[model samples]
Target: MRLIIAGLFALAVMLSPAAYAVQPDEIMADPVKEARARDLSRELRCMVCQNQSIDDSEAPLARDLRLLVRERIAAGDSDSQVIDFLVARYGEFVLLKPRFERQTWLLWLLTPLALAGGGLALWMHGRRRPKSAPGEDGSEAILSAAEEARLQRLMAAEPPPESPS
Candidate 1:
């Protein structure tokens, strides 16, 4: 009976809606404003949980940010205006997806630049490698004629191994 109750409890927990950091009091009365606030919250980064958005973080800073967004919406601030305010107050680090601007140009451009540089390096490496010579049997020869001759001479000079008793 205990095992069955435990199994049912586990199943109930699994079926429950995903928990969010937003508390009931933080939600705005107006549906449209609430939606806008939620959207903005998802875009804003949690200062305490650097990788998580304020909407998904339970930290005190995240809660404060969530309330600030709702407060801005209630005061009739446009979405862009709220974002600009946050950016001004906390800098670009407050945004989960940073704006493409002069200061962040290198952050946005580095990946493509690195990929292009790597491709150029690979192409140059391939060009510098010697082309293989085709053998009489239509197979590529891995060793030069001088190296092959030296290998043959070395093999001839080595004694034959005795058969196992």
Candidate 2:
């Protein structure tokens, strides 16, 4: 009885993920239609699950997305048309692969531009720095001999160091 119960528990755990909403029977029988549906599902958002793909999401919204995709495929809508319809209805946020033109051009280019800008800024800043030296003398190389003599006199006039004893 204990072993049977344990086996049943394991089986339920294994099958639980399949129960998340979409059933295999919902997919079209034609292989070409099925492939298109799969591709669209991967691109469409699970409106309920938000971050999950329609194909993998168990949300009611994901199921609706799946059904909508199949219906569009059946209605002779081409892939781009169906995607356009969804984008029109749901905004570009629904697309897993956002288009690169116009408003979204920044999304594709901003990071590299920022990195290159930052690299150039860093390179310029580094170029302005004097090469590493043993002491602070290198930083003060512009000072005249008179300035150094005055600074040395100031240092020499300081009180004697106190003993720690």
Alpha-carbon local distance difference test for all models? 0.90, 0.85
Model 1: residues with Cα > 4 Å off, grouped in runs:
1-20, 136-165
Per-model TM-score on C-alpha atoms? 0.74, 0.68
Instruction: List model 2 lDDT by residue over 65-88, tens digit each.
Output: 889989999999999999999999
Alpha-carbon lDDT of model 2: 0.85
**Which residue segments of model 2 deviate by more than 4 Å?**
1-21, 134-165
Clash count for candidate 2 is 0
RMSD of each: 5.5, 5.3
Choose the strongest candidate by TM-score. 1
lDDT of 1: 0.90
**C-alpha positional error of residue 133 in candidate 1 after TM-score superposition, expressed in Å:** 1.6
Tens-digit lDDT track for model 1 on 93-162? Answer: 9999999999999999999999999999999999998875567568866897999999999999999999
